[model samples]
Target: MKNFLLLIVLSLYLHSSFAQNLLQPELEAFYNPALRPFYFGVASGDPQPHSVVIWTKIVPENLGLQQIHWEVATDTLLQNVVQSGTGEADSSSAFTLKLVVENLEAGTHYFYRFQHEGRYSPIGRTKTAPEGEVPLLRFAVVSCANFPSGYFNAFGDLARRNDIDAVLHLGDYIYEYGSGGPRKKKKNFSRPHIPNHEILTLQDYRTRYGQYRLDPQLMEAHRLLPFIVIWDDHELANNSNVSGAQNHDPNSEGSWEQRKAIARQVYFEWLPVHDNPQRSIIRSFRYGGLAELWMLDGRLEGRSPQAKGTGDPALPSASRHMLGEKQTEWLLDGMKNSTARWKIMGNQVIFSPLNDSKVFSRDPSIRMDRWDGYPAERSEIFDFFYKNNLRNIIVVTGDVHTSWAFELTGDPLNPSKYNRKTGMGVTGAEFVTPSVSSFNFDEVVPKFVTWEAKRRFCKKKNNPHLRFLDLNHHGYMTLTLTPERAQADWFFVKTLYEVDYRFKQKGGRYIEYDGNQVKKNKKR
Candidate 1:
């Protein structure tokens, strides 16, 4: 420990002048002595049948290129090595290295690690997709990790478990808000945004990612399991579309194009996902004949701006797109051609139509930021599903910061379109995971609204297709897919105020392979 401290002090002394000259003093805070050069730990993602992307970043003591060595093996001891390689890391990518290690066995567990100058990083575990007839698969679906909101107890809980295959992150991984932003100002919480302002430039974004990666629980989760991620509004900005964001100010914040480009560049640099030449995150992963996971890009790739208000004439416009033209075509065609039994979509926002107007008089307009905003496109998709006899479709979504289970149909209210008792006309099922630490309805209006009352009000009479809802609770959902059914189990942590690993299984919903109906499961 003393030697590590001395090394840290020496690295600071050698790089302090260079860091100041670069005007990035905040970046220095991320350098921890214990972790040394590999302060950010390690991560793996985007697993395929024969390949997976392994990532690490080096905090060099000197301003020079780094030679990062990596290896993959079937065991944690790394005795029987399967592949090994060396890569060059430089400042252009903030010293981050993401290499796709290819030519490996399918449906297998592989341990990987990086080395630099004889020092080694933490060993990371990743699994490759299966080729045919997978009987069982599991994933922890999570999103909306606000750093300043509270401790990442949800992540900590998930990290301690070893049952899941991968962590499916549906965006808002790093909130762009600073210390004094709209987030709750709690005196008890010790965590704060490092830069102390909204991230706009490349350095600011990079610093934020560094701060998030420094978290022990998050880093441990990354080290233990491979992640399948997709971005939503907060990755770029709040309520982001292709043209602009609700958080951006044109006059004060400079050009939106520049800021968006910077955010995108920094995101690709920090994450372990492979970058497409066309910059599209719309990709598909086939888990043999059991399931296919289609991760959608709803933020950057040609999303139309939200409707102006409840009375906005463009709310029902067929031209207004959510996944845009190319992505929509790709998704629909892929879903149709897919041979897997379960078509699981890693969605960003609420894909089903949700209207809380009749239940709550104050909240009107049906949440334009979600699929409720693009009624025409949603209807078109539902029509396609119904016409093509698509069954056993499941969507796991995040970004709402609340838990929900909905039976997807064209119109839930119309008895002819959807039968709530039998779930006759349901086209699919959607399972929405709550935030890791973001504020929910309970936190926002704790003074007046009660969780019990709100939950009672959210009944079948109001929202016919709604199966389950948890307005308060910060945790993740575990999704298990098999040949017979796909089940989503919601687990909630006791508190996020402190480091609490204790959690309870609250509820669950499942859909069988025979149909798209959502059925409730008793708590375990």
Candidate 2:
């Protein structure tokens, strides 16, 4: 009987050993001398008044567990350490580790790094949002970073700047399309996506993210500053909504729900974002009394089908919702209760209506993918602000691939009805940043100059509220907020094709809410 018990125990021990081996397979086969275990580098996000999330991924040479030690210090030399801890890196989460270092003082700059097996990662810098009162706040805004099209010079430029508090990545952090698309034919891509195919599965998404993070420019941007990000269409699929996407084919891509789940899982795992029970990405961040940034999600959670064409009469239906009921309520309540001097909406798409009558017809032709498609919902939001007496609202947007500064007037079609002198019918002001690297109208058109001239003329003639427009440029915007006024300085890179590109100050504009006024500022 004793011998039989010993045999059973031995069998159990062997099974346990096999399970561990299965979870962590040999990594030597995939090892590269140049790629360290911390190849993806370090990143931090979701900053609060007292805490922030620090993230790192361990690429082990073997499948065994790795113990990662992290430290947060007031100085860059690690001499003045504030918080330190250790965590395990295992295969359960692609060997990724995220630690929420809490109980730190607010409005403070902190340096962080991770060490594994005696090898230390590059140090990262992060800062927590201010708590009570802040005299000033600054943020660098960017979006739509397509790796294959060009280099991330804009990100590198932003990384070089030391004035911004945090980086706001509106969306399209990574494009899922593989090579051989229309873009590839137009211009030779500097690099091709891994797998060389459209990503559809969790592993595929994770691999794509790994490839993007490998980019030195992008990696440096993450290493230098904390990023507050939201996923746009290309992160999952092109023109993606809640139920379906224009790029996703159900029969070929398998289940849409399953694909979305996989994409969301990978996004949450790879990014240093904090997830809630409802799996919603809509959240708010306050910078003391200076400003409150409401980062919104317009693609996934509760969006309806995009209008197909220019004259989709049903597009005006109230049932065609954008933020849905719950999120809309949350936004309205948040704005109503917010006491910050400036309420900045970190939105993915253009909030103000963009009308192009000459291009389409005498009637205003709107892009269905933006807020214009859901006319009733857009009107409801504007009405809420008007009725509630909300002021000092600044909408910072991306996704249009062009730079524009406009006043969100009540009647976008007929700007004359709204008094531009007093900004009487204007609810807010919008500053739309150009694409980081994605192709714009000029790049896509055969006759770039003619197309640009026509576009600018038509846009300006129809949309009088549009104070400025730069249809072709690749760069970002830096927004600075004070107690009195908020300013947005637009900067454009010399070129996206070159790795080492210089950014030039394009222009800038600011809004004063004391008397409801918008003005263009030449200062950068």
Poorest stretch of ten by lDDT in candidate 1? 179-188
Clashes counted in candidate 2 amount to 0
Residue 69: error of model 2 in Å?
A: 1.5
lDDT of 1 by residue, 1-524 (tens): 99999998888786876554433677666667777789889999999999999999987767888899999999989999999999998878878899899999998999999999888998889888888988899999999998888888988888888788889999999989876334455675677787888888877888888888888899999998889999898988899999999999989999999988988888888888887766567789988899898999888886899997668998889999888888888888999999899998899999987766655455554388898888888888888898899888898999988898888787987888889777789867899999999888777666356555465547677787888888888999999998988888999989888889889887678888877578887654
TM-score of 2: 0.90
- The numbered model that scores best in lDDT is 1
Give the alpha carbon lDDT tens digit for every residue of 269-303 in model 2.
78888766666679899888888989888888678
Task: Quote the positional error of residue 315 for candidate 1 in Å.
Answer: 1.2
Best by TM-score: 1
Q: Point out where model 2 deviates above 4 Å.
A: 1-35, 184-189, 360-366, 415-417, 447-461
State the number of backbone clashes in model 1: 0
